[model samples]
Target: MRSRLAARLAALGACLLLTASCTSVSGTGGRPRPTGPGSLWNPSAGQPSPSGANAPFDADAALRRIKRLGFTADDEPGVLRKLPGPLRAIHSHCTGSVDGHCVIVLFFHGNDYVGYDAHGTGNSSVVSQDGTTVTLSYPHFKPGDPMCCASGGTREYRARWTDGKVTFSPPLPGNPNYEEPSP
Candidate 1:
């Protein structure tokens, strides 16, 4: 009777061990198979990154390239058909796109510089054109401006990529963030 009891206990221990490991077995003998098209060892060891496998685009370098491709005086002068129409309609039309970014400046006669017309009165604002990134400044409105207080800050408007020069300060009052959304 003692021997039988010992043999029964051993069998129960073996059964418990088997169930503990096999109860949750996915597919392999003792280990689980990958849930979804995965490998246990080195699945991505040889794979490349999902994005930007190649060198990242350099904006500064690319701008230099565009300057190299600058408009040639030899080519016939005409309106740019590719860029989205000017954000602010003026008398002239000259637009260009760089790396999906665009700048539409009023093209004028030889030696003529494109200047800001100051959209009507009361909406006077100053726009700074430094290479790209037009910084629209409204010094009158400090950090406490009604609208941009939380988001836009004191800046009334921000017109970026100003390819042309804003020679005049437009009359800006009553309204802040002068420049309308790029049309």
Candidate 2:
């Protein structure tokens, strides 16, 4: 097995040369080692480290939990992302949707899904997420406003995790179609 060992050594050398780190190969126990800034292995890096919230958000596990909770995109495209704190956001286009989209934010401490942010209007848009805050923008439609352009402009809501729960500043706009409670 000398050739196999030689091949692994060559691969390891290449990996170190490319990433400038050998943590991925040396002693990771098959877990993905954090290679650099913004790596998914350390998705929660640089954020406020609350007690059990520092664990890296696992997008795959979140996706599985989302499907188990009866939310699925089916064949449509969707978004799943890590937010600040132990939070993950899912923007799915097909959850009993007639207009076809909704944003759901979930919180976790390690592997356990703990809570979620209040639902938003179906037409919600994520404006930005930074530090420990996530801002969502929603279009406000006036009577004469066309769907292409809302005459009532847009409203923004900022959400932060505090005291073991999500607190929305100005509160989350109502969701007329929302059903089911957070798991």
Candidate 3:
């Protein structure tokens, strides 16, 4: 009987150890499960943020700033009135590091903020961020290129975030297949 009871206790302790090892509690006191790259911990890996306290990228606010920088419909000949709509349609993707540094790309149809144009036509991607510097590589379509044809050339844009502001570097010459910098 003594040996049987010891064996049962040992089994129970082993089971408990296994269970504890298999699961961990996150800082929020929730069970820690494996989440993909773009999950809550990695906000920049998914869609752009609408607004948050000290969020790295706020799409609405960024659009407002871009407008203030004279990047408006008036700047483009073919662009009409700025369309009033959710900015998600224009947002391509966002990626970032754990330290509040992130990069977000907004693809403008026909290089215009007026409407939702098909991707890869005269589209231009604006990579913005509010974190550590990141570099992006995207195709630069030429004037009047067909939506299905290849890009005229490739361009690399770097954005550096510092002290609540981001500064974009001038376009750098690069190949179309250049790899993007990891956040």
Candidate 4:
């Protein structure tokens, strides 16, 4: 019985030592290492966290601003049911220097909201930018068509800063084949 008790104690001491070694090796100084999806350490795990302090513009805030402009989601329950969520819009932001000033072009899914003339048949993209303007291009689609599948044609709208606010110009004709270059 004495020998068995001694062996058990020895086994417990070994386990404690092993655990201590593992804890020491896994120490990230003091900060915990990011382990889940979208972690900076896991590059390929998910969408990389937006770089720079101004990246990945806020879509919710933009939506709120659009709402303030009198746009609202249509009350078609049947259509709303087919959507992924209450907010089906997705957005992207591209930041670059234009005329020596930081310019950010926010591209959002225009089709997610109803009663808007800028509703897109497909996803919008930041096609180009100049010294004083940024252009967003998207396809126009017929009524009741999903923005994913079909488009009537392409349209481009230019956004500019006016009085410290972003304003969009009426859309002009665009080329459907023009792809947005990465920032």
**Stretches of candidate 1 exceeding 4 Å from the true structure:** 1-110, 115-117, 121-128, 139-153, 160-183
Name the weakest run of 10 consecutive residues (lDDT summed) in model 1: 101-110
Ordering by lDDT: 2, 4, 3, 1
Clashing pairs in 4: none
**Ranking under TM-score, best-scoring first?**
2, 4, 3, 1
Model 1 — TM-score against the truth? Answer: 0.20
Candidate of highest lDDT: 2
Question: Against the true structure, candidate 1 has what lDDT?
Answer: 0.29
| Model 2 lDDT per residue over 1-183, tens place | 999999999999887685554223224223222233432222342234344556765556656655544355332222343355444334433245454434444444444454444344345555776536777666666666554666666777676666655566775544422332222
lDDT (Cα, tens digit) per residue for candidate 3, span 134-172: 455456445566544535576666644333223345533
CA-lDDT, candidates in order: 0.29, 0.49, 0.35, 0.36
- Which lDDT tens digits does candidate 4 get at residues 1-183? 999999999999999865453222133222111233321122232233344212443445444533333233222334333333211332222112122111112222222221111211124555654425556666555566663544467667765544423345763322232333222
User: lDDT of model 1 at residue 124?
Assistant: 25
What TM value does model 2 have?
0.51
Q: Can you give the TM-score per candidate against the true fold?
A: 0.20, 0.51, 0.27, 0.29
- Candidate of highest TM-score: 2
As a whole number from 0 to 100, the lDDT of residue 113 in candidate 2 is: 53
Q: Cα lDDT for residue 45, model 2?
A: 29
User: Which portions of model 3 show Cα errors greater than 4 Å?
Assistant: 1-131, 171-183
